[model samples]
Target: MEFGVFATMAEALDAANKAQKDLVNNYSLEQRDQMISNVRKEFEKINDELSNFEFEETKFGRVEDKIDKNLGGILNTPGTEVIKTRAFATDKGLTIEYSAPYGVVGAVTPSTNPSLTVIGNGISNLAAGNSVVFNAHPFAEKSSSIAVKTFNKAVVDAGGPNNLVTMSANPSLATLQEILESPYVKLLVGTGGPAMVKTLMASGKKVIAAGAGNPPTIVDETADVERAANELYLSTGYDNTLMCTTEKEIFVSNQVLDRFTNAFVESGARLLSEEEANKVRDLIFVELESGEKVVNKDYIGRDASKILSDAGVDVEGDPRVAIFITDKDDLFVQKEQLLPIIPIVPTPNFESAMEWAIEAENNNNHSASIWSKDVYRVTEFGRRINTSIYVQNGGTSAAFGVDGTGKDSPTIATPTGEGITDASTFTRRRLFAMANGGNYIL
Candidate 1:
């Protein structure tokens, strides 16, 4: 079974399936660990090149930020350690359950985090003893193909099976369709918008989908105003705010709103006046034929200075974040803007702030955060948001393990309810029972 990019999806699927079988039957857990280690080291060695290519090809995020993103994915994505064996003992017999592979997985990578997604998913899927046939986003074909090829080389060099990772040289909708229809692909993992989630769900296979999010942040009077302001500035400015987890809209308690805004300005964020904000809204959004107003694709992931400049608003210094006050029903609060622009909605009290936070999240249940010192407020906000990634007094990147504890993965399966996925999320449970003394230890 040969790995790397294949001419056809059929060839990739066949080779991937064979490679997954080899990993399961011929390779031991120790061998898998070695392979994963090689993959991580190789990722580090080529991190610069991969990040440069992805940034240049996709033009979605900053190169420096993409570099950090790749490093986070490589170093923090958990391996076989997450998989565990469970056993139960009964009066008559014993039963043990093992984590088993789902064979070959059909993964659809997104353009937003092309190489990061591939490498992270590859590490996770391979760690679970499964091979992957990636349907790379057409816009990021070259970068994604390079990632797949590099991953496969690492596995082979570590004395593991070849074709552990595979993708199409010509990634397109046709190839994605082929993967969906193929019987050999046992599971589906996708990270993209509503359309991608819908497509994967309709495939009728077990799907781990990472969909869109309008993450809302809350800042109450009890919060450390300076700390909250600084963290918000960094979170909304990181990677030009391309991540779905970035705070889109925020509800602030009126008591602390002015102080927070002042501290935010001190942190290099420019507060746009209402008139300037309206101009920005006009510049960043466009109305569709169907009367739907959405963020202009041109401004997505662009720098704050550029976004503000084009809106005819000039600033004296470099500003990484552009924030403005708006009502809860404003389009900026309702829509998930991928740019560094943020909407600040002021509430008279904490209770109203919480209510607005839930409403602004749009029920995506993807990611939300709160800046507060009150433990009761934190607990209540966490429960009310009901999001997969909830941050307490930290930036959104903390949830992804960049500046926080634990592992990181680009594919946050919010829709599929896996939260932050790792190797165990890719596997199934296989139970073994024996009539008497079934469990080996028992």
Candidate 2:
């Protein structure tokens, strides 16, 4: 039998509402900890299941990579950290500052990293003492439901409310409206495209919308070309580049472009044949809804050989998809093609490279990658670009603990004015003051 088989979004919402009421009236810190433990355990059990579902449903990333992402959410992403309370005695007697839950939370999950996103947000919300109502993407409803069910079962087995984590079976336009319009939902978190973010912001409620990103990775002449190429390939190949923080474009200095290209090719990357390259260009550079040419989904996440074959080209063995040495003014350089294909743009110097890189990034502020030994150059680039993560000497994925020191969380693209979404991002602070036999000035 398939995993997700719930009745409807309304039924799920009702159940979650009841559970939230019960939790507010009876939940405890011990139970909360138990829920976290259960969530972690369930994550392990369903890791394989979610991975299979993602590959079967979306086919946009590798199953192994997906498993890693889901596991990371369980192990990291700040679970159950205390925000602590402090009391200070002043002329007005006593004042205290404490962090509290925002009641029931409504979260919109995206298809790119379905299970991981839900698990990460759900764990954070539970740690912050809030119940959640998750509205999964229509394309990822099954995986999303499985994650929610697994999480809720774990919570219930751990002495918490059964429906503490709830989700809709079939999420539609009307169901999303219900969630957004419901006054019971205290906080709203969305992860997807620009339209979704815009809608959440216009809902007249507090929202954390993780939106679109077109990150540019700049490689200067002074950088280690081999290391930069390796990092770039690994980051972009991670889950087939489903991550918004993945390096979308490459800006290389002319002095090192040839060397960098050689290094990239040596790292199992093959340049596309003329016929294969043309096919990729046609498939990716397609007409958008507004009549603008955009990258199509067919080419996204496919293996190089498969992409070439699909485009009616035959190769002896596994051949990389379209790879081209192009000028910065080319359409490919300006566009964010979420596929295996990468465009190498040459710039005269660091200044020109940085300028083109920033323009290519287009101020998405999601993430950017830089490879330079010069401390000042890295610092200067970091200061100029307002990205949530500026990864130096590595790929964009490194920022999310992919191959770096940071803890893993689906790097929130919207950033929502908050650089990173973790434990503190899920709660609000409230202050208490007392006036005991002390006169205070107004």
Candidate 3:
């Protein structure tokens, strides 16, 4: 099996399959845990350098946010610890549950989160006793390669087999399709956009996919305006809004619109006039001949200065957040603007705000948030939104368990209804039966 570089998808598949046979398929629980720990250490050792490389290679995201994302994948992403077994007993038989692996896994990662996604998915896949073959994004090929090589080395250094994680040198649609068609690749794990997820699902293999989102946030009259503003600014401003869970739009109840606005402005945020907002919008989103507006990828994860400079505005120093006003029907509110730009909309009441926020979420069911102290209103909002992840009076980072508060997951499978993915998401349930056993719960 190859060690560091793979020239083609076939090589990646072959190496990963060999690793699965030599290490993953036969690893004991203790051995798997040791390897997982080693991977985490290796990640931390190179996280700072790797994060900088990720930013340099992809030209997206803030180095600070990438560092945090790398650590989140290590500390928060669930491993074998989340894997559980269930048992039941009847008069005639006893049944025990086991989390069975999917053999070799084919993972397709995005440029936005190259190393982060690889490590997060690698931890879970290894914990589930499956070797991984990666199809890294072309723009992030170098960073992804470094991460994969370090990860594989970590496993081997911990007395694990070679090719525990393998990837090709350059990634393309052809290679991704090739890996998906490979017989050794038993399952697919995708962390990317809609088109990539669609392709993986259509491959006739079982898939755990995490896709796009235009997350929405609401500020009600009962909320603490300052806290809300700070949290919102911190999230969207982080890494120039590269996170899928970053707040794309905000809906504030008209009752506290003035208060929210003042607080939002005090939090190092600069609001553009209606005319300026139009200019910024035009600069951020380009209109096609087909009448559809799309985001300019060049500015997708760029900083505030770059985006604002393009909008014909000059700033003294680096500002944290750049916000503008937009109506519900505005293009900024309709589509996802994956930059430090956030759209604020005014709603008449709590109900209207909730409706507007939910509508802005676009049914991706990925993530949403609200700022409110009212217990009843919070409960109502949570129930109505029913999103995969709902942050209450907190930033979008809460969805990733950033401070050890919420659930940690790499694959937030919204369509499959497995909200926050973990080691359990990668495995199937198997039953072990004993003929003469006892029924306890019954």
Candidate 4:
């Protein structure tokens, strides 16, 4: 159980290689489906255990939402979907084309989605006929370990290789490096910060690096202010906005600013008092190494009441949400503050709002949202910012399937590059060609 001491990268690779060979050697398509089904059942059994671990360890989102993500991973993270294959008889003989697994996969899980990421990536890699060696986030070690155990049990029960999915019992910087440098690791799939993604990309290996994001949600004059406020509230509060697909900033047209703010306040969000706002501005903002003030990490994902209390302000009511009304110039509006706090910036018009929104979004280049009744306005805004996901008439969480959004799994912070970490997100494709009747050459 103590993966830190016993589970070296070499051991992980050897186990994974054996699993891959077993998959190619023993299991046919029928066996693969049976294994997939067994894994899905095991996921259901461990759902509550993983959900509890995630809530206790990360404290990032709701327990219910985490459970939903676990189930979604089991149900919809993609399976073996084969494209067209061909066989032909040539003058020389017969030729056939087929797809095969890429051998051992090196996957790194993120803390924000500990259980869901493990299950999703595990299922995807299995479907691709590859074995996996996961480097889970240190913060969610218990959850990650349980996930690995559950997967391994499922595989073994289904007549597949044991340890087909392996992970370090205790993930650390040293363990991560060993996994990256291992020769048996054929490909890398990462979901973490920019530093980690950059490290994986530089390892001289094939990597599917999922990076970071600063998503923005836009509300224009033509928007349904009430619906937009409701959707935004749901998105920003879903699992405390842990998802990279969640809206990090809101850009509202001056025409609808007051209406949207009022609606937001009516929906259990509290506007910080002037004195309290000043305290938050001091406590939440800090100077970076470049001497530029930025939102402090201490407040990120902390409850609004706790943030205010730490800033020496006390509130009588139960207020979980923080509303900051500031100009676009404020550091609060211009950055990806990953807390329950929302900054509402007003622009003169829709055009100006879109421009300001894009600027506020900055380099994160992830996802954005819009709440508009006008189809043209939605289309225009989608065209303008050009984020990975441009949600209309809904919160940013809609991109990830929470609160009646489209049916999708939880997304990783690496939105700009890989978007979401789904089944295909963890795979690579190769083309196979066969000559029919003639020996042809270029």
Candidate 5:
């Protein structure tokens, strides 16, 4: 029977539970590795097609960027290698400690990263010997269903169980709640906004939640102005700035603000006038009944040029990013605008820049970056921000393993303190002891 797609969450969870049992009882570690390898290879073969499908379905983010993200996540995600076993031998007894799966993991993926999240989570969870039941965002159900089906096919091709990865044919908030409260789900992993994270945290299960972030980027006077501008534009403008790691606000040293902004314009960034900036801001944010300004859902992840045009600005060619000078107090500077529009704040010194950046980060502690030549300033900024992912003199993409040292991960669990989760993150350490085994030489 086909187990990848089911009519209800209960069926998906049941299939996942049975599949996890099969994985632990019948499959060897080497066989699990084979399954992971098959998944990576299968995803690489169809990454471009899946990326294009997600873009067409959700109408969010750039297609090329989606391809890059899905490819990197599939290829670079650490698999069974991260699952380690340790042995302690003594004269009296021998003890073995190793990582064990959490059984069926219920995953809640965001619309912004539909298939990428499902595929990455599947690889990690399956590598750790667990099965998965996915509750994809409603806006991305069809694309995410394809991902679930792909994982099941790849695993089966490698002689793995058929229901290793499963999901509901139709996903919704109701199904998500069912997964959260289901007794069969041993662990929960979710990636989305604060509300989603909060719901998972309250589910009374072991949870790994990747929440919202308003990452800040700082440019100090000691930095390379031109290089900083180019890097900032590339990162903040990437995929229409959909990644949670993307720089939402920028703090630049006043001594080189003009040069930095000018260089950014030269690098295909659209420099908006104060009037145009205000118009764009008004277009993207709305004041709530509580008098609090929040980002408008309609504008999230829209192209920079399209946003400018919608705001009545006479946009030219194709601007990769839109920029404007703004005070630290501006609503746009404080909020997380997933669009390519960026607000640059000028600061008097390195210390003030760091302070303002931390303040604007709002204690999310998700991701932050600094471009500075001075090691002392870099160190200080890193200590002050206390973000989960910190980049020094580089763009935020580096933190996502795009031409950098970090590994690719669709779920960055900042709130739960598991940064860039892998196979090990989904497992629990288990111990086995043998009395008087005489395994130790000493």
Candidate 6:
């Protein structure tokens, strides 16, 4: 039998609360591992369908990108492996610490991630001995429901509770508020924009909020220009820059600016003229009555060719990224667009370049990358920027532990200060100590 969704938020919360108790009291670590493994299997089975559902339903991001996100969320996201019990032994006594779950977690997933966020949160939440009630973004409810169903089915098949992973058939702000206010929901994890993050923080519950980011990728004079350009463009274009860690701005040292531009162009990045850049800017961003600038949303994460065409530029091939050379003070250079549009700023030296990169990041402290052979300069920039993710000689993928530290995460929780959350991040740490106890074995 297929999995099902709850008719009301009340029903979903009740079912999830019971499921959490069952999961914590009845299931062992081994059982949890089996459930997680089965969840991965389910993702692999319907990877193609889930990706398609997300793209067609949300009309945001590409199918291929969704496939990667699905795999990452299901298999690569940190689970029980990242969660650890710390122990210290002395001559007199032994002190140990344990990680415990917060019972039921109210996880609000975003439209940008939808199913990916649901599965990723599900794996970690369950691994930490908690059940989740997903409050999906309304824009991608269908796809998110499919993901929640997959998680619940896989968990049950692997000998877990029936409603261990559940959600409402229809998601709304009211439902989210209900979940936030419910006593049955012991903890909260939210991934979305600033408004959503602020609300989660104000819910009076312990919350892990993954907020906004405007990541900057800086290239210094010491780096290989062509390689940096190629890698930078590839990273910026990935999934049309929908990922929070995607590079929004590029800061290049003037010494290598020309070569970098040539290489960037060769890597299928289209450079927009100043006149064209203004037009593209107007097409992408809109100023409100309060003079606040926001993205057009419709064009966000769309194909670069499609966005460029809509912006009135006729192009033959599909350009991977749309880069505009603009002043450091340009509005396009300031705000986070979440689109394939990239702004390039040329600095006289690496110091000025780093400064510009830092300014562009705007203290979000989420993600930053650099292509440089100068270790001193890289360290200097890294120290000053102090972002959660720091990538060197590569894109945000590498910073997500791809070919680097290997500490990948779908939820880079910035506002909460728990960067790159895994199973450990979801658990509460408790200490146990023995006063003057005997040592057992060697």
List model 5 lDDT by residue over 1-442, tens digit each: 6748999888898989989999999999899899989998998999999999999999998888888878988898888898999998878878999899989999998999989888888999888999989998889998988898888999999999998888888888889888988888999999888888888989889889898899999998888999999888888888999999999999999999999999999999999999999899889989999998899988888888889898999999988799999999888778887889999999998878988899899999899998889999889889989999999888887977765787888999999999889999999989888887556666
- Local accuracy by lDDT, each model: 0.89, 0.77, 0.83, 0.73, 0.89, 0.85
State residue 395's C-alpha deviation in candidate 3, in Å. Answer: 1.1
Q: Where is model 6 more than 4 Å wrong at Cα?
A: 1-4, 436-442
Of 4 and 6, the candidate ranking higher by TM-score: 6
lDDT of 2 by residue, 1-442 (tens): 2122347766666777777778767877667777799889878887887788877887777788788878888888777664467776766677777777888888888877888887888887787877788888888887888888788878877878777777767787777888888878888988877788888888899988787788888999899999888667777767767777788778899899888888887776766655566776776677867988877767677766676667776655653333667777666678776676777788888888888888887777878879999999999999998788889998776666756777666537454876668766777888777777343434
lDDT of 6 by residue, 332-400 (tens): 678887788889998888878888888988989999999999899889989999999888888878856
* Sort order, lDDT high to low: 1, 5, 6, 3, 2, 4
User: Candidate 2: where are CA atoms >4 Å away?
Assistant: 1-6, 82-91, 273-276, 313-322, 411-415, 436-442
Worst 10 residues of 4 by lDDT: 1-10
TM-score per model over all chains: 0.97, 0.92, 0.96, 0.89, 0.97, 0.96
Query: Model 6 Cα displacement at 331 (Å)?
Result: 1.8
| Model 1 lDDT-worst window of ten | 433-442
Off by over 4 Å in 4: 1-6, 82-99, 288-295, 316-320, 402-407, 410-416, 436-442
Q: What is the C-alpha lDDT profile of model 3 across 149-267, one tens digit per residue?
A: 88888888998987878888978989988888899988898876788788888999898888888888889888898788877878879888887778889998888887877777788
In candidate 4, what are the lDDT values of residues 1-442, reduced to their tens digit?
3221135656766777777788878887667778888999988987887797878887766677678767877776666653224565657545655555778888888888878877777777777788888887888888888888888888778887787788766688887888788888888888767788788888899877666667777788877789888767766866666677778778888887889989988887878766777888889888889998876766666667777778887765756567767777777777667677777888788777777888877756677877778788778878877777667777765665645555455444343356665545555555444545444332
Candidate 5 versus truth, CA RMSD in Å, comes to 1.3
Query: What digit string (tens of lDDT, one per residue) describes model 1 on residues 338-372?
Result: 99989999999888988888998888999999988
Off by over 4 Å in 5: 1-3, 89-92, 435-438
Residue 125 of model 1, lDDT score: 88
